[model samples]
Target: MAIYMDEIVKQMLQLSCKLEHTVLNSDSEPEEWVLLLDERQYLMKQLDEGILAGEVLSDHQKMLLAQIHGIDQRLQPIMLERKQGVEKKLREIQRSKTAVDAYHEAGPSAYGAFFDSKK
Candidate 1:
């Protein structure tokens, strides 16, 4: 049981480190960020399963959890900012589409006439 808990904690620590690096690196692509998030979720699920299985964390494991919590605090604001940016972009795109659709619905000016009597 100790071995299993240790392995889970180790993997979580490594993944948390990787996630921190990815979040800090501006050059890291969005795809990579998303992949890391998915991995993090999976690791969290594993941790949950461990707890549900009646596994007790050692003192060291508790310390590791605290470290992970610290990383999470740092990550939250950055992730929320990114999410807001994406949402803003989507809203802009939607507005542009609506304008284009309205223009198309107008379907050009059909009733127009111009006359010059003096030639």
Candidate 2:
């Protein structure tokens, strides 16, 4: 059970890292975000429960934990870059939307009146 749990934790962490990066790149859909958050929360809960239960880990599990820690460390910069890039994209989109909205609001005409009327 401990070994399985260790494997589960490793897989969850890897998925979390990937999803986090995706989110950072503005590539994460709402569903993906939810799934990633859920997995992270579940893994945290499992780790806490396992620790509280004083579970005995096999050698393989111990090794896996260490490996996961190392992988997480290596992923730090990638995670940061992804997050910053996503934020920048979102900000750019928001600024563009605001500018367009302002342009439309300043005029009496609706920007898409022609296309809407023809369709």
**Top lDDT model:** 1
Candidate 2 lDDT over residue span 55-79, tens digit each: 7766876776676567567657765
TM-score result, candidate 2: 0.58
lDDT of each model, Cα atoms only?
Answer: 0.82, 0.69
Residue pairs with clashing backbones, model 1: none
lDDT of 1 by residue, 1-119 (tens): 77887887878888888988998887766788788778878878888898999988899999998998899899889978887988999999999999767665644544563333324
**Candidate 1: segments with Cα more than 4 A from true spot:** 29-31, 108-119
TM-score versus the correct structure, for each prediction? 0.77, 0.58
How far out, in Å, is residue 76 in model 2? 2.8
Instruction: State the displacement of the C-alpha of residue 54, model 2, in Å, after optimal TM-score superposition.
Output: 2.3
Q: How well does candidate 2 score on lDDT at residue 78?
A: 65
